[model samples]
Target: MASDRKIYKFDEVVHHNKTKDCWLIINGKVYDVTPFMDDHPGGDEVLLSATGKDATNDFEDVGHSDSARDMMGKYYIGEIDKATVPLKRTYAPPQQAQYNPDKTPEFVIKILQFLVPLLILGLAFAVRHYTKEK
Candidate 1:
């Protein structure tokens, strides 16, 4: 069981974020991926970029295959101590749109003024052309 696995502090894992000593925390499990860095399809840079931080989101975003997930055990060293990690927030807050009350009405008026005239002119031209002899 993973419960019997070694527990590592996030601070300790952070120190191994180099090319020669890379470690990553993904979904709470720690991986010493240095041995496989050169063989990484996305390259060592991708693995290096996820270092020193909880990379669960980054890992999940890439949508790795089942085999890729299976390969994780090869480098599995331990699990990170969740309590040692500083922030626990999982997802980021949704961004709110800023309503520019000062310019919204003015901008809409200017756009409609230009668009309405163009639309009317286009309609007139089309109607005149269709009604002509040809």
Candidate 2:
């Protein structure tokens, strides 16, 4: 059997608020596909046609790899009927985080080195406390 495997049918719609994109639901789950529309190898038109509509027929036609099928389950949220799904026009900017790999390795090493001693000390104290109780 396919582990965590899901099958999407033709009647379901997936709402992805973050990317302002809606995916068609197949079986029982949602898939976030805002990022894929523009980057898709088939071109934006194909993706656009399916926007706010069930794209189950379109997706099967385009051909995705087995791995892509497997990873799709993580993005599932909920379901909507194709006719009731709304179009999202606004796109949110990418989220920014403080820690990016662009920072030098030396800086990363320094941070790790600083944290290591404190972690060791904390562990040592925990061990001592547990031993004393025993």
Candidate 3:
């Protein structure tokens, strides 16, 4: 059945990433998810997040039910050109922890570290003073 479908290039699919016109590739097949975005059981964000990208892993990782898999036929627009389809899809690199000590002034943090304990102690004393017998 897929052999009869139109073939789309990688560059052609990338152009439809926007919310207004979303497309996704899964297992070398292209799907026009724009119309079904709102009706998606997982909500539009899940579909939107995968727009214009190869979502085969993401889709399979979610463990979609048989019915859900069957429903994909409705959105089937075409198949990605086999010659252009990548064996390994590109993924965003994991974000590095952003705890640069040099980014923040050490003196300001030190001041807060000192003042926080003092403020807590002061609040405790104030509460005690007001609650004490006349």
Candidate 4:
């Protein structure tokens, strides 16, 4: 059965991200979701947003009903070539320092913590006085 199914590469899937040519991968299977976009119960945007991408997580995250899962058969186009699928990468901005609350000076944070409530209280009293005068 697997040999009978068409196989698509990652680049080929990425090319179909647009609304008119949407394709998605879920659990190593490629699906052309263009026709089903308008009919999707979750609306077209949900389908379009996953176009030309691996939507396995997105699809599973939604906790789709059994009926929805069953309906996927209609859009099954092929299986992805596992070797061609790109590895997911974590992005870190160059030359940017990560914020660490633990590393921050306690004195500065303490001053900010104290000032915030005082500022809020002062603003509230001012607003109350202004509203009373009106």
Candidate 5:
């Protein structure tokens, strides 16, 4: 039965990324979701954002319900040519610097902001008390 499905090129699927004309390729299957765009629970922008690429990750991440999964058949148009799909690069986000409570400039500044005023007021009170006693 899979052999009967039409195959679409990756380049051809790239063109339908607009609100009025949108297509999505998820797990190699092509779906023309234009009609369901406005009706989509996440709104049309969510579907439009997944265009021009393999949206399998995006689709799976949302954890779509079984009914949602079954609904794909209605929009099913074809399968994408595996050979035409480009290899995507793995994303590794930049590591954040380790926060050292004893060394961070922001932490030091916050401590100083609190303590400096207290120290100033204490010194002012001490000076006033001493001068008044004299």
Candidate 6:
């Protein structure tokens, strides 16, 4: 059988499943779009079939809230070719740094890296002042 299914971009908001009943990814997170799409008031065709394209235009016309816009990038699951697609890095909470008793060596390195620029600036000023007196 010929399938009309299309491959979508991960940056595009989507919701899909083997049965196509559950809203697996909406705007970016896994959501239950099964009941919502059917009852979506704006009609289900656009939202349900919008799996593989930039659904931003469709979503804007649907009158969703600012929070919905925020969620859009969270559920987008599409193509991931770093060379072609410019991927937006969404900060995940569990993956981010948190208050811990032990200090991370990586954090120490980053702090030192930040200080290096200031040190260079100070060195440049000192050299300029010393050379002016000579």
Best candidate according to TM-score = 5
TM-score of each: 0.63, 0.38, 0.60, 0.62, 0.64, 0.31
lDDT of 1 by residue, 69-131 (tens): 999999999989999987953432222124545447898999999999999999999999999
Among all windows of ten consecutive residues in candidate 3, which has the lowest summed lDDT? Answer: 92-101
Instruction: Identify the runs in model 2 with alpha carbons over 4 angstroms from their true place.
Output: 1-20, 81-134
**TM-score result, candidate 4:** 0.62
List, residue by residue over 1-134, the lDDT tens digit for candidate 5: 87898999988988887767888999889999989976999977688778877889999999999999999999999999989988973432222234534247887899999999999999999999989954
Candidate 4 ranges beyond 4 A from true positions? 89-134
Candidate 6 per-residue lDDT, tens place, 1-134, comes to 11432334444322242123533333323344545553455645545544443334555566888876665444443333223223443431121124432346778889999999999999999999989954
Candidate 6's C-alpha runs over 4 A off are 1-19, 22-32, 65-134
Better of 1 and 5 by lDDT: 5
Question: Which is better, 1 or 2, measured by lDDT?
Answer: 1
Which sections of candidate 5 miss by over 4 Å?
89-134
Q: Which digits, one per residue and each the tens of the lDDT, describe model 2 over residues 18-99?
A: 2345454444345666666545667544555554444566678867899868867666645533444335423333332334
Whole-model Cα lDDT of every candidate shown, in order: 0.83, 0.55, 0.78, 0.77, 0.84, 0.47
Our tally of clashes for model 6 stands at 13
Which of 1 and 3 is the better model by TM-score?
A: 1
Mind giving the per-residue lDDT tens digits that candidate 4 earns over 1-134?
Answer: 75799989888877776556678899999988889865778866687667555789999999999998898999899999888876872331222124434335787889999999999999999999889954
Per-residue error (Å), model 1, residue 89 = 11
